[model samples]
Target chain A: MKARVTVTLKNGVLDPQGKAIEGALGALGFDGIGSVRQGKVIDIELGETDKAAAEAKLSDMCEKLLANTVIENYHIDIL
Target chain B: MKARVTVTLKNGVLDPQGKAIEGALGALGFDGIGSVRQGKVIDIELGETDKAAAEAKLSDMCEKLLANTVIENYHIDIL
Candidate 1:
């Protein structure tokens, strides 16, 4: 099974990188751009075939390593 | 309008960061993990309401700044 995990900053958190990107976009003349936030996407190929088990495992991985839960949220999708 | 941009390293590119994550996962006792790849996800809020125009502008952004096209690929999704 293949899975994707998206880790993003929580609301109210300051994202300097996002801010920089927004500024860069403006400088490049791309108008109408509002807030921009950056995150991580991890794609994994797993040997496990069971979808349920894979989701569970991926969730655990997020808690343990993939996400910094204090300021970030993670979502998992099985593909 | 909200949009998402995903940038990922193309196949055959050496991703040391991803390799390190894979090794770390194994060290943490997570087995059956195959190849792990890391990518970037950028969420943007745009003032443009037209989906097609927004997508075109986003594609331009990707080509000019967001993605290093020589070694990466990007996908855009408007929501």
Candidate 2:
């Protein structure tokens, strides 16, 4: 089974990297850009075949290592 | 309009960051893990409302800045 985990900064958190990208895009002549926020996507291949079991394991992985719960939010998708 | 761009390393390309994450997960006691790849997801808010135009603009942005075509692939989603 394949699973994907997306880790994003929570609302109200400052994202300097996103700001840098936004500035760079403007400099590159892209216009009408409102905001830019960056996040992480992790694709994992698991030996587990059960959909529910894979999702549960992915969630545990997110809580334990993939994300910092205090400032970032994580979503798991079983693919 | 909201757009999302996901940039990922091409197959056969070496990803040290991904290897590091895989190792970390193994150390953290995650079992039955296979290959792990990491990528970037950028969420952008565009002033434009037309979906087709927004997608075209995003494709251009990906070509010019978000992705390295030689070793990375980018997928754009309009939401």
Measured by lDDT, the strongest candidate is 1
Looking at model 1 chain B, report the run of 10 residues with the lowest lDDT sum.
B15-24
**Top-scoring candidate (TM-score):** 1
iRMSD (Å) of candidate 1?
0.5
Candidate 2 chain A minimal-lDDT segment of 10 residues: A52-61
TM-score per candidate, in order? 0.99, 0.98
How does the DockQ of candidate 2 come out? 0.93
Q: How well does candidate 1 score on lDDT at residue B25?
A: 92
Worst 10 residues of 1 chain A by lDDT: A40-49
> What tens digits encode model 2's per-residue C-alpha lDDT throughout B1-79?
9999999999999988889889999999998999999999999999989999999999999999989999999999998
| iRMSD values, candidates in order | 0.5, 0.5
Model 1 RMSD in angstroms: 0.5
Clashing pairs for predicted structure model 2, backbone only: none
Per-residue lDDT over A1-79 for candidate 1, one digit per residue giving the tens place of the 0 to 100 score: 9999999999999999999999999999999899999999999989899999999999999999999999999999999
